[model samples]
Target: MSPEFYTISQVADILSVSKETLRRWDNNGTLIPERDDGNNYRLYHKSQLEQFEQAQLLFQSNWNDELNIKASRPYKMLELFAGAGGLALGMEKAGLESVLLNELDKHACNTLRENRPDWNVVEGDISNIDFSEYHNEIDVLTGGFPCQAFSYAGKKLGFEDTRGTLFFEFARAVKETNPKVFLAENVRGLLNHEDGRTLETICDVIDDLGYKLVNPRVLKAIFYQVPQKRERLFLVGIRKDLISNSEFDWPSPYHRIMTMKDALKAGELYDCDVPNSEGQKYPKRKAEILAKVPQGGYWRDLPDDLQREYMMKSYFLGGGKTGMARRLSWDEPSLTLTCSPAQKQTERCHPEETRPLTVREYARIQTFPDNWKFSGPISAQYKQIGNAVPVNLAFAVGRSIIKTLNIIEKNTAMNKKKCA
Candidate 1:
């Protein structure tokens, strides 16, 4: 059967143009289509549009940097706090091998093990794990260690001062493994956490561990094929010896944004619609109220009386109160996925459903493949998926890391030849 019809509005979005422009193009006979049903809604057959170079560009350019990675050796990776394996999986997809992945959460660990039984899923506190065994064997150490305030008692905090924080454990592993490169990730808030002293201290610790820190940058997920506006600060370090010889390039952003529709439907991100799976439900009255919200609309869109009734004292508060009753739009990247979809402070209601997004929906928004199943109860699954890095974004970063490794390896070989 032919694909389902898309309205002019949908076509405009797929082309990243306005509906009026699409209409103008239609009137001028620049863009025409075949008929569909009785309603006479201008239906463009998916096949008729295939010859358009722009459409081909959209398809060809989808996740650009991810598709064009330079050739590099298959470097081994040891990941710490590897939640749900998003970064690890993306790196693996980019050709890095996950020699070991450590996570404290049983559910996340189980999910990792269930998906890839071959992975060395180390389920425990990273502080207790001895990474020294992987020394010289692993080429990269990566993690999303939780951001914590450093005990900045002196001019420069050293590795010992970082003890007691998970980042310290990450550092200790870097020290133990002495990998050629390391990449640490965290929320964008880390840039200003404790008024920036925390990050300065992190840089200091990486330096103490004999690695030269790259000027860390926070990358927007929406620009990297993640259908969400989540921003993460990436801290990259190269062993000081390699930094002198190898040039590093951060991944370039894609020209397009992957939106909610791209995530849930079969257009770009996946081959089919998001799978039906478990999701959080709103209370009856709340769901009834939220049903009135238009796609892309939020609580402020509610009727005056309903707004007062639902929001109570919050109605009088200062900010836009946006997330309170937000409905997602198909054409825009979703707001950052939170740990819980239906939380009062950070609601992510489904585009069509009155309830919160399902675990599978959340996973798709994060660019997880459909076959990659999550373990544990429904709630636990949601948490694991929600907390993950978007796999596509990770892949883009992974390609950059691989490029850095290639340069380093090539320089090392050239140096050996010179000595010989």
Candidate 2:
């Protein structure tokens, strides 16, 4: 049977707050826990937690209320920088058909083609491709283009001024396809990249291309059912003509946060425990040192001598450097994954095991289904999965996009009837 009460740490993880915050809340009488037999340990009854906003999501009854939006008719999407099909898979689950997917990486292209043989997987440089043939043929054009700084000659940047960057190519596709809507996903850093001028220029370029840019929002992946604390900034643009009629809404957050357990174990997110697969191993000395670090701890948790030895001169340096020698806790979300999980500065060690997260485990954290086969060498596979937009997060956003398209479709049909 499920436990009747939760410890302070358990409640903190469930609410995604630090223990200190819980202590403050306890002092404030916002959420007071009962003392155990010895009057030492604080225990929270499960029923009391139900009153908080975050805890409400954990209830099955609450999940049922979230909108189950669907595509009214077949909608087509063209994806760029489509790595290992994470976003594509989510969009597919959300009922959007992929007409064409472009990726410069050979391995990623092969992975896409291998999984969905019917998808038009375009391989090689995006700059060489001409998208005019797809003009007005697609419903959405989406990409997670790499953020690059534009060479501003101190002039007001416009559509043509962003020519040298990959974003320009993305914008070019938007212009050529003339999709009813388009989405661009990038790292949260893009919001303040080059002191926010890059994003400002992107907005201006979107306007020049005859698209109305929505106020971009940074979406926290953990809030969207992904068991990783990844943040992605999304910019949605609607074609200028459709802007007046379109009503676009961001996807709602999932009721409760998913934990590492949800990703790897047989739970709501998956039907089976994660299958064993290849993963990187730590060196003997490193493994010995890490064994001493507790789950949910980093290098700082090591003994003073070991800390100095393991961290070297960097130990004297400042900042938390929390990812180093870090081990995940089963109850909390995993850290944002990187291209290499075993790297010293950003280790993603398994919660109970000494080694790094396995290839399949890595994929699981990113919300890729068990059957989504990744191509190329193991390292390439890791890179592809690491670089992907979390599949579930993408699905949530895709559902919102579909809902907006449905409204647009209904309005268009109504206008046609009026003309008749």
Candidate 3:
């Protein structure tokens, strides 16, 4: 059986507050519960808490204990454009504390706040927020800022050239915070975006801001324990000053790649098969057409007349159009999940059923914990899950950050000793 009672320290740790604060709240009747053996020891009975609405919610939804995963030291981070807290939660699991997180989406913000009450979530446009408050305090800064092209004013695009784009805010935050390191993650398309000039300009801006950009690499998530064929371009930077004695290493790939079966079934990923949950339904005729496609097959597998019927005007268009009517295979990693599973251009059909993937399946592919509830309508939840960085990928990156921070701390301590 689960423990019948919790210690003062346990409750404080779960709520991410202090024992003194809990005692004060208990004394004031703000969170009053029964007393222990003596009146001096204030104890909360688990049964009585069921009646208190707020306490009940706290009892059910807390994740603070999971936050205390192994780490050499607590490193602080300031994240920009944090979506659904995927990267933040992953980093937290890897022992980095999210001192502040900024996200513009209200629904995503609600998801973060509902899960972590103490987190300082700034829910608004990044342009309006100032990073000066975090200056010199944050050990690292990170953002998956959207890619946009800036009109080049000269041979080198200065900070002014990127003023209107979201990347400028990311650069501005890095410049202002002057952290020991920062990481920028983007879609793989960025490497070739704008005939590659856009990425070149971004690198120039980062270099101009006085950071050493590592040879940016596209890390495939399938190599990192994420059960989806997702690829992201990771641009890691270290403040020029910190690069002398330390080398930053990206997380090593897991020994084995996880397949779609590993994601949705009850095996390595979870103890039980996915819980039945709501999922998108294909149109009746579309479902019938897709049902004919074998596992791992797409629209091309359909009969010629059905393909012509489904393809419509697009049948005459050039290129493969491979995403149409695709069915995932149990043994293969899923093709990158799209925002709308039912979209014709990018269908991720269920391997067995002709329906789109269920919400739980989507979360599993993204490596979100089963109990980590999202907040919103079904569509909103799908969008949030689809847009997020896979939590395991984030955790892998977080471990690298901790490793780098450890090196920085050691070097700093050595310098101090020499001065002393």
**Candidate number of the best lDDT:** 2
- The model with the greater lDDT, 1 or 3, is 1
* Candidate 2 clash pair list: 57-255
lDDT of 3: 0.83
- In model 3, which regions exceed 4 Å deviation? 1-70
Query: lDDT tens digits, residues 210-299, model 1?
Result: 899889998878767788878899999999988877877777666556789999999867999888987889999999999999998888
Look at candidate 2 and tell me the lDDT of residue 56: 66
Best by TM-score: 2
Q: Model 3, 1-420: lDDT tens per residue?
A: 135665564354334456678879887877775666555555666775566553454455323332333556778899998988888888887888888999998989999899899999999999998899778998889889998888876677888788999999999999889998898899999999989999999999999999999899887787667888888999999999889856787776664457788998899877888888898898789888999999978988989999999999888899788888899888667889888788999999989988999988999999998877788888988999999999999988887777788888888889989999
Runs in model 1 lying further than 4 Å from the true structure: 1-66
**Global CA lDDT of candidate 2, please?**
0.89
Candidate 2: C-alpha RMSD to true structure equals 2.8
Task: Provide the clash count, candidate 1.
Answer: 0
Q: TM-score for every candidate vs. truth? A: 0.85, 0.91, 0.82
Q: List clash counts for every candidate, in order.
A: 0, 1, 0
Clashing pairs in 3: none
